[model samples]
Target chain A: MIPTLQVFLIVSAALFSAGLLAALSRRHAIFILIGIEMMLAAANLNFIAFWRFNPQSQPPTGVMIAIFSIAIAAAEAAVGLALVIAEF
Target chain B: MSSAAFVLIAILTLAAALAAATLQKLMHATLSFAVALVGVAAFFFLLGAEFVGLVLVFVYIGAVAVLIVFTILLTRRDVGKDRGANWSGALLAVAVFGGLGWAVFKTQSVAIAAPHIRALTVKRIGEALMTSYVWPLQCVGLLLTAALIGALVLVMEEKR
Candidate 1:
């Protein structure tokens, strides 16, 4: 019953595509930022999926990377929004 | 059962993402983006990454999304008008998706065996972060602190 790696990959791909569409299509600065965040989320999902499905008994590198990605994303949002606000 | 759960979550995620991308209103798009973020967090949970899932919720949904909303509110008058989607951008997105999909399908034939599910406790993650990942952890902390300070400086009002 568990979803396979392919399923996760496809979902992430779709997410990435949607994000790309948003990023490229949106005219508002904030919407563009949201799209960028979605893209980051898509990449994070891929990392987690690959980590989950990897056959090797490895360290929790993928999870750690995801954690760092979230942190960086938070930072990016803060700075990006501040810049957006300052521009106004 | 689990596949069904995944399909449902995937549908929710993609739908929210589509709405976020296509919505004309900034507020509505932000809300949809929040839903998409929550969906991604749910995905992390389903993948057995409990710690990451919680962080995704805490950091993304709680902090980032709120920050975005706050920014929008602050600059509401400036960004009141919503513009239509750019056709060129849509075309680019479609091209990128097609290329990526083709790549994925081409490599789909490689049989990657399912990994055994191990219980990943928060304690183990903490241990790893403090031990092997200490350098990166410290670096990220520094980066976040710098970003906070920089944002504050950027938004500070100047007197005439």
Candidate 2:
């Protein structure tokens, strides 16, 4: 059986914390981008978890959001890496 | 959807994430970051979001990770060198995690298992984007184009 929503939330929280640690502790710009991407993935995990656990959901809202969110994150990664290269 | 599988994925994800955050070698840390993303995709699949899982693996691992590795190689720094973790930053991360964990435990959720519904197909998602979410779709495309051009401009060598 699927684990409770709380378990997913806790895992997502841990992922967020790790991402924060990476972003804050690292001096390199690329590390910061990696951290931000990790954090976004954690949030996406939460969206899917919530969508799956909710018994009353009708539309595939979370899936759609995750798709768009992935696109935005990809764009961000491109721009961010370019900035890192330009700055150095 | 077995709890055992979830536990395994959780362990893999957390371990990879910690390694990514704490590893000394920049290259190693970036690789660990890629591994962590894979774990996240696995979680998405476990939760029955197969399409999202595939996209996560495709975009994140295929495009983003390769870009990061190339950036590291192109920078020509002593990537082996390590400043290591900033203690203050680590402390802040710990504090935030503690608070979030407390909040998560406090909240109540009635559903313990995934609900039965029609399988989420890519066609349905396509229809939704074309109909109800067409505006946001167009806007995202516009934003992506802007970001692409802006990035190219930023990295362009200045004229003498």
Classify candidate 1 by CAPRI docking class: medium
Considering summed lDDT, which 10 consecutive residues are worst modelled in model 2 chain A?
Answer: A54-63
Per-candidate fnat, comma-separated: 0.80, 0.77
Model 2's chain A TM-score stands at 0.94
* DockQ agreement of candidate 1 with the native complex: 0.74
DockQ, model 2, C-alpha based:
0.74
Clashing pairs in 2: none
Candidate 2 off by > 4 Å = B158-160
lDDT of 1 at B37: 90
lDDT of 2 by residue, B1-160 (tens): 7989999999999999999999988788889998999999999988888889999999999999998888887777675456989999999999999999999887765336567767777787788889888998999999899999988898784221
Q: What share of the true interface contacts does candidate 2 keep?
A: 0.77
- Quote the B-chain TM-score, candidate 2: 0.92
Put down candidate 1 lDDT per residue, B1-160, tens digits, no spaces: 2778788899999999999999888888889999999999899988889789889989988999899889888887857557777899889887887887777767864235456767789998999999999999999999999999999888884211
